[model samples]
Target chain A: MRSRSAWTIFWRTVLGRAYPRIIGAQREKSWVFFEIFLPLLQVTAYVYIYRAIEAPPEFIGFVVLGGAMSAYWLNVLWSMASQLYWEKETGNLELYIVAPTSRMAILLGMALGGMFATTLRAIAVITIGMLLFHVSMTVRNVPVLLGVFLTTLVALYGLGMLLSSLFLLFGREAWHLSNLLQEPVSLVSGFYFPVRALGQVVAAAASILPITLGLDAMRQLLFPAMLGDLRFLPAEVELGILAGLAVLFLILARRALAYFETLARREGRLSIRGQ
Target chain B: MRANGSRSEALRSLRVAAWLGWQIESNWADPFVFAIYSLVKPLAGALILVFMYAVIAKGGLQSPLFPGVFVGNALFIYVPAVLAGISWTIIDDREHYGMLKYVYTAPVNVLTYLVGRGVAKTMVATIAVVMMLLLGTLALGVPIRFGGIDWPLVLGSAMLAFFGILLGGVTLVTARHNYGVGEAVAGGLYLLCGVVFPLDTLPSWLSSIGRAIPITYWVEAMRRALLGERTALFSGLSNGALVAILAGSTVVLAVLAVLVFRLAERRARAKGLLDMQMMY
Candidate 1:
C-alpha cells in the first residue's frame, strides 16, 4: 500500500506542475498585447472582404466568418521561429540545457503559450467583426470546426518545434533560419486571399500543410454557397491529408528534438547556447 | 583652476581618446562578418516571393497582377527583406557577444564611428540590392530599363537605408543597457514601413497612411526608376523632393544616434552596464 501510494503521489505531482506552468505562461503580457494588435489590423481586412462579397447579408456573413477564421492565421512563425534565436541571444535558453525537465515539454509549453495568445487575438477580432462590421456568424458543425482547429494548431506547433530543433543544432549566431520559415509560410498560406486562387502548383504545395485543408474544410461549412463551385480535392481528402501532414510534421519534430538533445550532450556546450 | 593642472588633464583625456579610437576600429571588424551572415535570410525571402508569385500567377487569379507586376513588387519587397533580415544583427551582437563596450571606449566619437558602420552596412545592402535587381531582370524576363538612373528613388532608398541603420544603431546603444524587444523593434518597423506589397493592397485609408511614410515615397521612387515610368519624372512629388526629405532625415537620424548612445553610456555608467559583458 505504501509503494502504490508513493507511485500514485508521483504521477499526481507530475500532472500538477503542468497547469501552473500553463497558467503562468499565458498570463504574461506578450500574450495580451500581440493578440490585441493582430486582430486590430482586421479593420482594414473587413473592408477588403466586404468588397469581395456580392450581397449585403453575404458581406456580413463573410466578414464575421473571415474575422473568426483569420484568428487561426498569423505571423507567429517570427515569434515562435525565433525561439532558439532569442534563447541564443538572451542566454536564457541555457536554462533548458541544465533543467531536468523534458525539452519537449519546454518547447510545447512555449508554443502553447503563443497559440493561446494568437487565439486570443482571434477572439478579439471576432468581437470587433460582430460589433463594428455587423457580422452575423452562425454556429453550425461546431465540433468539426474545433477538430480542424486542434489539428491545424498541432501541425503548425509541431513544425515550429522542429524549426527550433534545427536552430538549436545548426543556427548561425544570427538564426536566419527562423526568417526562412516565417516569411514564406505567411505568403503561401493564403491568409489574405484564397489559396485555390493560387492555382495547382501552390495549391498542391499548400495542401501538404494542415492549415490549407483546415481553411478549405472550415470555409466549406461556413461559406458553402460562396465556394460551392470551387473543387479542392473533396472534403475527405483534405482532412485526411491535413491529418497526415500533422502526423508527419510531429514525427519529424520529435526526431529533430531527439537528435538535437543528443548533439547537445556530445558537444558539451549545451549550456553555452547560441553561436 | 590652475593652467598647468588643466593641461595635464587635457593630455590624460587625449590618451583615453586614442585608446578608445583603436578599440572602435577593431570592434567594427564584425561588420565584415555580419554582411556575409546577412545574405542567407534575404536570399530565402526572395526565392519564396518569386516562387509564390509564379504559383499564384499560374493559378489564374485572373487579376491584373501579371508576371511583370510580380517583378515590380518583388524589387520593392527587398526594402523590408533587407531591413527585417538584417535588423537583428546589430542588437544581437551587443546583447549576445558583448561588443558594445568596445564601441563605447573606441577613440572615435560614437556618432562618427556609427556613421561609418552604417555606411558599411548600407554598402552591403546595396550589393544585395544589385544582385536582386539583376536576377529579377535577367531571369524573370522583366524589362527594368535604367532610363537614366532615377536619382530621386536612389536618394529615397538611401534615406530608407538611413532610417534602418540609425534606428538599428540607436536600438543597439540602448538595448545594450536597457532590454527592449529586438524582434518587435526590427519586425514592427518592417511592417509599418510599407516594404512588401503596397499597403494599398489593404484599403484606401490605410494606403494613404502608408503613402505618408518616407519608405512609401522611397519605394514608389524605386518603382518609377526600375519600371521606366517618366510620367511622374518631374512631378512636384518627384524623387528629388523625396531625396531632399531623405537627406534631412539622414542628418536627424545621425544626431539621434549620437544622442541615444550618449544617453545609454550615462545610464550604463550609473547601472554599471558600461563595464558589463567584456568579450575577446
Candidate 2:
C-alpha cells in the first residue's frame, strides 16, 4: 500500500509540474511561431544548397527528417539539460533539493514538458516542409517507425537527465558546456547528410552518437527506397541498440545524481547564481 | 568635474568602457578553454557545409562550388560573435548584472559608449575570423588565391560591413532593453542575412526583406572583394556599388537607432521598467 501511494505521489508531482509549463508555452504565441518557423528556414537553406548541386531528389526528405529530429536534441540540451542551471538561477533548485520527492521526478517533469512543446514545433516543421518543398516520404511500417522514434527519445532524454546533474554540479560559468553540444552534435549526427558521406574513421566515430543511428534508422524505415544504400545497421538492430542505450543512460543518470550531490555538497556549489 | 562635459572627457570615458568590455569578455573562461571554445564552433560549422557540398557533388571538396561554401561559412563566424557581443552583451548587463541604469546615467553619451563596446567586440571577433581563414586554407584546403587580392577594396568593404553590423546591433540592443528577446533577433539575422545560401532563391516577399538588410550586400561584397569571384547566390552588383549601398545604409540606420534608443531609454525610465525587463 505504501509503495502504491509513493508511485501515485511521484506521478502526481510530475503531471502537476508539467501542466503549467505546457500551458505557458502556448501562452507565449510568438515564441511558438518562432520555434516552428526558424527551424523550417534552416532546413530550407540546406534544401536550396542541395538544389544548387543537384543532389538526389530524395535528399530533400532526408534533410527534412534530419532537421525535425534535431529539434528534439536541441530541446534536450536547452530545456532538459540546462533546466537545472535555470532552476539554480531562479531559486527553484533549492526548494526542489530540499523537498522529499525523488530528483528524477523533477527531470521527468522537464522531459515530458519539453517533449510536448518540441513535438509541436517538430510536427509543424515536417508539415511545412512537405507543403513547401514537397519532400517525398514513403513509410513502410508505422509500428516500426513509432518504436524507433520513441526508443530514440528515451535514450536522448536519459542522456539529458545525466547532463543535468553535470550542469548542476558545474554551476553558471559552464554554459559553454551546453553550447559545446549543439554544433558538434549536429555535425556528427549528419543532420543534413548521411554519416557514411564522411570517411570510415569519422563514420565509426559518429556512430557512437545514438541520434545518428536513430536518424539513419528512421530514414531507412520511412523512406525504404534508401534502404539499398543504408550506411548504418538495419532498423531493428538500430532500435535494439537505442533501447539498450536508453537503459544504460538511465542507470548512469541515477548514479550521476549521487555523484553530483556529493560534489555539490563538498564544493558548496548548489544554487550558486550568476557565477 | 564641471557641469558641462568636455569632448575629450567623453572620449576618455568611452575608451574606458571599451577596455572594460574587452576585459570582461576575455575573463569569461580560462585562456585554454577560451581558445579551444573559439575554434570548435566555427570549425564545426565549416565541416557541416563541407559535408553537404561533398554529398551533393559526389566528390569531397573537389566540387567546383566548394570554394564558395568554404569562404562563406568561414566568414559566417563574424555574424553570431559580433551580433551577440553587441545585443546580448547589453541584455546581459541590464538583465543579469543590473548595470544598465548606471551605464545610461554615465556622462559619456550612450551612442559613443555603445560604439566603444562594439570596437572591443570587433577586436575579439577578428581573432576568430583570422583563425577561420587559416583553418579553411591550411586544414580544409579552400582555394583562396593570394595573387587575386584587392587589398583596398577588401578593406573598404570590411569597414562598411562592420559599420552595418554595429548599427544593426544598436537597433537590436535598443529593442532588447525595452521589450526583451534580443537573442531571437540575433538568431533570425543569421538565417536572413544570406550567409550560406543566396537570397535570390527565397520567395519574392522574403527576398524583399533580404534586399533591405545591409549584411546581405556586405557578405556579397566581401566575397567579391576578397576572392574576385562573383557570388553564386545573389548580389551580381559591382564592388563599388555594393560598398556605396552599405555605407549609405549604415548612416541612415545609425541615425535611426540612436533616436530609437533615446526614446526607449526615456520611456523605460519613465515607467520604471528597467529592472522589470529582466523577468522575461
Candidate 3:
C-alpha cells in the first residue's frame, strides 16, 4: 500500500505542476509566441553569420541542433534552477517544506515541467530550421540518438536540481548568479560550435557538462562528415557517464536539500527576503 | 512663479535619481565580480565568432576582416548590457520594489527621473565598452590600428549612440508597462540590431528594419572611423556628413521616446495598472 501510494503521489506531483505551467503559459498567447519564435531569430543570425564566412552546409545543421539544445539549458538555468528563488520570494518555500511530500518530488515536477516546455519550443526550432535553412540531419541510428537525447535531458535536469538546492541558500543574489551562468556556459559548452574547436584544457573543462558530451556524440553520430570521428569518447561510454551523473546528482540533491532545510530552520534564514 | 519652482524641483530630483540609480546598479555585485562579469559575456562572444571566422576564412586570422569582427563584437555588448539595464530600472523599481506609485506621486517629473537613471546606467556601459576594447586590443592582440582615425568624430558618434540607446530603453520600458512583453522587445532588438554581422547581408526585410534603427548608423560610423578605407557604407560621404546623420537619428529617437512615454503614462493611469502586483 505504501509503495503504491508513493507511485501515485509522484505522478500526481509531476502532472499537477506540469499541467498548470502549460495552461498558464498558454493563457499568455504572446508569451508562447515569443518564447517559441524568438529563439529562431537568434538561430537565424548565427546561421547567416556562418554562411557569410562560408562554413560548410553541415555546420549549419550543427548550429541548428546546438540552438535547439540551448533552449533546454536556458530553461534549466532560468526556470528549474531558479525556481527555488522564486518560491522563497513568494513565501511558497515554507509551505512546500511543511508538506508531507518529498522535496525531490517538487524538483521532479520542475524538471518534467521544464522539459515539456522546452521540448515544444525546441521542436519548433528544429522544424523551422530544417525548413528554412534546408539543414540536412541524417540520423545514423534512431535508438542511439534517442538514448543520447533522453540521457542528456536527465543529466541536465539533475544539474538543475542540484542548483535549486544551492540557490535555496541564497537571497536576491540568486538573480545575478543565474544571469552569470548564461553566456559563459554557452562558450564553454560549445553551444554554437564544436568543443574540439576550443583547446584541450577547455575541452577537458567542457566534459564537466554532460550536454557537451551529448552534443559531441550527437554530432558525430548524425553528421560524421562535419564532426568526423573526433569524440573524446565512444557514444555508449558518454551515455553511460551521463546516466551515472544523473543518478549521482539526484541522490546528492536529496541529501543537500535536507541539510539546507535544517540549516535554514536553525539559522532563521529561510524567510529572510534579501540579504 | 510656480513654473520656476517646479523647474528647480525637477532638477534636484534628477540629481538624486541619478545618484540612487548608480548605487542600486553597483551595490548588487562586488567590484571584482562586476568587473569580471562585464568582461566575460562580450569577450566570450568575440572569441566564439573570431574562432569560427579563423576556421572558415582562407587566410584564417591573417584575413583582412579579422580585426573588424573583433571590434564589432566588443561594441555589440552595449546592446545587451546597456539596453537591458535601462529597461530594468523602471521595471525593477515599479514592479519589483512596488515603488512606481510612490515615485509617480512624488513632485518629480517621470521623464526627468528616467533620464537621470539613464545617465548613471550609460556611465557603467561606457566602462564596459572601453574595457572590452582594451582587452581585445591588448590581451587578444586584435590589431586596432589607431593611425589616421578621426578621434573627435568617433567620440561624437559614440555619444550619440549612447543617447539613442537610452531613449530607446525608455520607449521599451514604457511599452513593457503597457503591453506586458519585456523579453520579446529586448530579444528583437538584440537580433535585429546588426550586432554580429553587417545588416546589408541580411534578408531584404530584415535589412530594412535594421536601417530604421539608430544603432545601425552608429555601428557603421564606428567601423568607418576605425577602418577608414575599407568601409562600403560611407564611401560617398565625408566624416562630417556621417556624424550629422548619426546626430539626426539620435534626436529623432529621443523625441519619439518622450512621446511614447507620455502615451504609456496616460494609458497606465487610465487602466489603474501602475500599482499592479508584479507576476513572477
Which one is best on DockQ? 3
Q: Please give, for residues B222-259, the per-residue lDDT of candidate 2 as tens digits.
A: 67755678875554577777767867776776676666
lDDT of 1 at B154: 64
User: Between the candidate structures 1 and 2, which one is better when assessed by DockQ?
Assistant: 2
- Colliding residue pairs in candidate 2: none
Sorting all predicted structures by DockQ, with the top scorer first, yields 3, 2, 1
Candidate ranking under TM-score, highest first, comes to 3, 2, 1
Residues A1-275, model 2: lDDT tens digits: 98988898789878866775588877877678767766776788788778767788788888898888888888888777888887787678889889877788878887888878888889999999988898878888999999998888888888888888888876545566777788888888888887767766876677666788889899898776568764566889888889998999889988898799778978888868777
Tens digit per residue, CA lDDT, model 3, A1-275: 99899888878877776775666656656656776676776688788778767778988888888888888888888788788887887678888888767788888888887888788888989899989999888888899989999999998998888888888887766777787777777778877777777877887778778788888788878887744634566778878888887888888878888888788788887887545
Q: Indicate the DockQ of the complex predicted as candidate 1.
A: 0.13
As for candidate 3, its interface RMSD to one decimal place is 2.8
What root-mean-square deviation over C-alphas does model 1 reach?
7.4
Question: Candidate 1 on A1-275: residue-level lDDT in tens?
Answer: 97777666545544443343346545655545545544444334334323422223544454354445444444345555556656655565676666555666666666666676567566777676667656555546787767776777787777777767766754444244443444344445544344565577887887765666776666665655545554466655666777777889878977998897688669854555434
B270: Cα error in model 3, Å: 1.3
Could you give the TM-score of chain B for each candidate, in order? Answer: 0.64, 0.82, 0.81
What fraction of the reference structure's interface contacts does model 1 contain?
A: 0.05
- Residue A145 in candidate 2, Cα distance off native in Å: 0.4
